[model samples]
Target: MSDMTMTAAVEAALPKAPFEGRHLIDGIWRGSDNGESFDRTSPSHGILVSRSARAGRAETEAAIGAARKAFDDGRWSRISGKERATLLLKVADLIEANVERMALLETLESGKPISQARGEISGAADLWRYAASLARTMHGDSHNSLGEDMLAMVLKEPIGVVSIITPWNFPFWILSQKLPFALAAGCTCVIKPSEMTPSTTVILGELLLQAGLPVGVVNIVLGFGQPVGALMAEHPDVDMVSFTGSTAVGKAIAAAASVTLKKVALELGGKNPQVVFPDADLESAADAITFGVYFNAGECCNSGSRIIVHEDIADTLVEKVVALSKKVAFGDPLNPETQVGAIISQAHQEKIAGYVKDALAAGARVKLGGAPVSHPGLPGRFFAPTVVTGVTADMAIAREEVFGPVLSVLTFRTLEEAIALTNDAAYGLSAGVWSENVHTCLAFARRAEAGTVWTNTWMDGFPEVAFGGYKQSGQGRENGHYGLEEFLEIKSVVMRVGRTRSNWVRA
Candidate 1:
């Protein structure tokens, strides 16, 4: 009985693991210059979970320089693919061993449920293993037909130093998808994690050192976006920039990198669509839609904020969605039974609430939720699950990314209309087609303007599958062999078997 109460008390308190410290450079933890620091707040508690060093322009520059020097001086880039593969697999083993600690940190920093955090840990570990195999498979090309008796081959080499700027949402997962593959491709990186959530990133940097990565190969500059990320984006020493965030900021990064003619890969935001056909199983469709929009408190880049449903089943789907929304339990993230946790911040929660207000002002009806709940007793930043029906294609709430638990419901008639509605957005990261017919699924896959198209599945991603966006959603893939290439550059090596250039021309 005493042990059970202890568990209950732990659950009630929502005990968050602390990671109060500064940036890690050259395998050492160091504070920011001028003794500067920033607080990382938990959405579940709205209090500082940890205090980390906030890098200024000088610190950012220092990190970039350190990374450049690491790549130029260290043997990481010159290491054979087989050796790199071995180290990568070792890192994967370490991450798997420490999965619980990482998961708890993620849960505390992001206010996601602990169970979900564990799943993220597993997914991240899988990426490391995938990248390890890809390291050995990181080959360019060799050809015999280029010239008779001539040997010509291409080498995919590291693109010097890289700056990876990740956002607050999915910090661990995004960095996992990025850093492992970058290291696999023999590239050193200086990272600037989102200021809002920096605890896990800082801790993971420490873990990399423990896993045998060389000093300065992975530097952390934990600070705000404007100075830290912006300066890194335009840094001349940086060879490439891989960003995962909003499209607006991605454009700025692209512009910044263009000045130096460096490579840039962006995995930006999306107003992704979820199409529910009349023939889709309403039970499964409602469950899928509920999780699609509300997972991570609708903070995901590919969250299905816009739901385009067939007019034949619109009312029925709405009813089923309302029922499912009622069943979604919300509370402290540490509780295993809590399906929904707090939004990332109070400002973000209010931002999501404003969408519901505007949707109502635009003549849409709130099918369910559409309100905010205050837990004055609890420290977490919580918001209600909301669904707005009677939405049109052009409405701001339907078109813009709410990035909250609010979902907009709109109806369509024909296949063209459905496809047109799905394609109408300015962003196209991911999309889903809910149907039992193979023909319709194939057609949607062909026509949908998205990097990832899921048939009857929403928000499904694995380590092996390549993920990114088209157009404004951002460039490049994030997983598997495709992602490893983003951190590499190709060069052609030409050789002749028996003839010298001068001898062949003059004789």
Candidate 2:
């Protein structure tokens, strides 16, 4: 399809009115007590897409209080596992029923392709369903052989009120990654979604209410991180904080939560790399590399933004990857045909451009697009798919998280060198190795410092598999059975029958 046709189609699909959202506190929808508000413009369309109540200290505190009360009073925390599972399954059904609506807002607010947004929203239902299964199957351990008249048991109990903060790139998906798991563990929560992509989270709130969740079991406060997220992290009433965002912000949240010694689970930044060897299938590896760097315009924590290629095939692999990247569609997000969309904002676009510029000045060469480009009849910000060759290990572009659709190429001579280069980065969220040899794949998998290792593939995730990072990539895990355990505290109970226990003190 022509660019002009795609632009017109995107414009036609634009929402006629912005989504109006208010805070969901104590099961009631209400405006900010101080009458503060914020507006979110569609990053792909340059038009207002949502207007949300800007929560302040009062609203944040109130939400925290409500969650604390609900958890302490056992409104949700003491419910039967079957009851929680039933509620979660209903939510999953409701989410699937409203997939198109949620996907549209997500695409507009986050500038991801509408098709990808639909897939993410639709797939999020699976997370809720998986969490439901966890709710039913969750168990504790019991010891029956301690003695004839004595027994010991270990119980998994809810961690009380939790604070969940999600990022903008995959707002709905990430929230599902946390909220459902927390709920499955019988914990009440206060949520703070990124202001840039707040609408979909608000819509999730509606679905939760429609599913008949009790008051204060789930509360959402909308605003910037300074007040809304800061309060959620540090509040004395909260027992845990689960955050997904930049590494810098994760550190701040950790510091704030430390004052009260609350538990903190963070899925932070990643400068993940995909290592390619000579014996690998060049065609398949090149295609996966292209998809990895450009997916969601590379505004992802797991973006394969850098590649470590064996020097033997570096030139050939770079040629194939560049050609494949050029074929990937980049344009209006509302158009189903467009594979890549706008940058989140003009400032982010500039930041991406600045990285390429600095790399060039530092002796790197741009083999493909290295600057921002305009789309026909579109006012939104966009950066072309960029690939930089001759990038050294010390270059900022190679080491830092650019968070854009920019790929850096570096060469390694041996398997040892490849693994070393991959592990050199400060962030170790994930890594991928492409090769036909079993020894090579296993060695890379075992030696890599990342939380997840992909052999002959990239970015393939399931709700049943655990995910998180190591080192500066942040602490804790999300998804799978481990995700549910993140919101639980273990307690040990000892019982003595027939009053057989001896007393140390004289009666």
Candidate 3:
């Protein structure tokens, strides 16, 4: 179906003005106490999409206070696992029902292609369903080996008041990754979504309430990262802080939360590498590498921006990559045919372009598309799908996380050199190795320092697997049972059946 038909059908299915510019606290929509708000504009066309309330310190405190109350009062945290599971299932159903509207809002606010947005929305519903299943299976432990004299058991208790701060890119998808697990763990939360893309997340607040989540079970406070995010990180009442952003910001949040010693789960930046071996299928490797670096405009934390290839296959691989990248469509995000949409903002576009410009000045050869693409009358932030050859490990473009649609190609003479080059970077979130030989690929996968390693694949996985980083990439896992564990605290219980001990102090 056409893009217009899809959008028209979605509009017809939902009510107008679903997203309101207000904070969702205590199960109600309200304005910021400071009377501050901000306008969210479409990065695709620089048009205002919605005016969301910019919550400050007071609002942040209020949200935190409400979450704490809900948890301590047993309004949410003390609920049965089956009950929480039921609520989460309802949330998943609601999300599936409203996929069109959520996808449209995400595209309008974040400037991603409508098709990609729709996929992310559907994926979010899947995540919610998966987490709901986990909620029912959140089991503790019991040991009968203690015999009749004593009994021992381990209980998993909820870590109260989680503060979630999600990024602008993939706003709803990332939020779904963290929030559902937190809720499944029976933790009440206060969410601080990115100011650049707050509309869809705010709309989710309504869905949560409609799903029958109790008041203050999940609150969303929208604002800049400074006062809102910083305050949430440092708040003493908050038991844990879960953040998905840059390593620098993660460090700051970790340091600030250290004051209260709150549990922190960080999913940070990455300089992922995709290694193509001489024996690999060149065409498939090229296609996978193109998708690795160009998907979501390369705004992904695990984006394989570093392309390390065998010297023998370098020429043929680069040729195929250049050809495929040229065909990547860049245009209005609402258009279904546009594979590559606008950058998150103008400033980000400049940052991405600056990396390419620096590489060119450093004597790097541009295999194809080293400049930004301007679409007349669109006024959206768009960069060309870039592929640079002759990139040295010492260059900033190869070392730093550019977070753009730019791929740096570096050739390796041997398997040892390929592994060394991939591990040389400070960040190790993910890596991809392509080879027909099973032993060679398995060895490469075992040696790669990244948390996730894909053989003959770039970025492919199910939500059941654990995903996170090693070195500077991140601190904790984000999917499966590991994600649920991030928000749980272990407690041990013991009971003596046969003996009553006399106190030594009495003697």
Candidate 4:
């Protein structure tokens, strides 16, 4: 089907007028106190989709107050783990029920392909479900090894109110990454989703209510990062802050939250590398390489934006990647055939273009697409899938996180050189290696200065595994048992038998 037909069908299936883009505070949908609002334009068509309230310090304060009150009341936090698990499961069910609507809204706002959006929706539901299971299974430990004179134990308790700041790339998915675990840990939270894509997250408020979540347990404030996100990090009542965004912003948050010494978990940016060996399956590696960087228009934190190929197959692999890049369908996000859709905004598109231009000027060659694309019906921001060759490890394009669909290629003569090139980046979130030699792949994976490594595959992993970063990329894990533990504080208790106490000068 044509892009227009697909767009019409999706809109017909899920109408958009019913959604109210506003701050969800204490279970109420209200505008900012100053009545200031901003238009949210669809990236697919550059048309106004909704007018979202521009929340500021006032709203942030209100959200913090509501979360504090809810945490203090202990209405939700005092509940049994099984009860919280039941409610979380309900949320997962509700998300699955509205999968189509959720997927459509995400695509309309973010301009990712509808197919990928659907998969994200499913992944979110699974994430919530997994968190629900953790709610019941999570427990502390008792120890009798200290001595018969004393009884000791450790208890895991909620960390009170949390301020969660999510990014725009995967609006709902990233929020799901933090929210479910926080809720499972019996903590109240206030969410600050990226202003560029706040529609679906605002829509999620109603679903939370439908799932029987208590009011003020989950509050949402919509606005730009400066006031909303900044206020959240510095709020005194907030016991912890969890953020997912650029490394620079994450650093700012860390510095701000340090004043109160609150627990902070940051999932920051990455400049991931994909290393291809001479003995690897060239075709499969090529496909994985393309998907690694191009998926979500390469606007992923752990995207394999850098490729380090062995010199022997470097030329042939570059040719294959360039050929695959040319075939990437760029059009309306609703179309199933469209591999890449509109970028988040025109400014971001220009930023990506600037990166490519700078790389070209710095003695690099554009092996494939290197410019913006203009389609007849799709009037929004769009950039072509790009690949650059002859880039050094020190180039700006090679060093910085462009966060767009632009991959830079670098050649290495030996395994040691490839490892060094991959580890040269400051950020170390993830890496991809393609090699038929198991010993070599294992050794490279062990030596790579990244949090996670994919062997012969990219971005293939389960939620049960812990995922995080090293160096400047991030601080803590985001999934598995570790993710749930991030929201809880450990308390050690010791008791004296028969009221025995050590007396020195008194008593």
Between the candidate structures 3 and 4, which one is better when assessed by lDDT? 4
Q: Each model's RMSD to truth, in Å?
A: 3.7, 1.8, 3.5, 2.7
The best candidate by TM-score is 2
Worst 10 residues of 4 by lDDT: 1-10
lDDT of each: 0.83, 0.93, 0.87, 0.88
* C-alpha TM-score for every candidate: 0.94, 0.98, 0.95, 0.96
Q: List, residue by residue over 1-507, the lDDT tens digit for candidate 3.
A: 111111111222222443566899888899988687888777876667778888888888989999999999988788888999899889988988898888888887888989999998888888888888898899899888986677888999999999999999989989999999999999999998888889888888999988888998899898998899999999999999999999999999999999999999999999999998888988889899989898999998988898999888888898898878777776778777777788898888889989989998998988777767666647677777788999999999999999999999999998899999999988989999999999989999999999999999878867798889999998999888998999999999988876665577974
Q: Give lDDT for model 3.
A: 0.87
Q: Clashing residue pairs, candidate 2?
A: none
Judging by lDDT against the true structure, name the best candidate: 2
lDDT string, candidate 1, 1-507, tens digits: 110111111334434555786887776788988898877777776656778888898888888888988899866888888988888888878878887877776777788877788888777888889999898888889988966758889989998899999888888889999999999999999999888778778878867888788888999988988799989888899999999988889998899889998999999888888898988888898999989888987899889888899999999998888777777766677777776677887788888888889888989998777766754446667777788999988788988888988889989998889999999988889999998888988898899999999899888788788999877898999896788888889899988888645555574
Per-residue lDDT of model 4, residues 1-32, tens digit only: 22121232233343546345899899888998
Candidate 1: residue 272 Cα off by (Å): 1.3
List the candidate 4 regions with Cα displacement exceeding 4 Å.
1-19
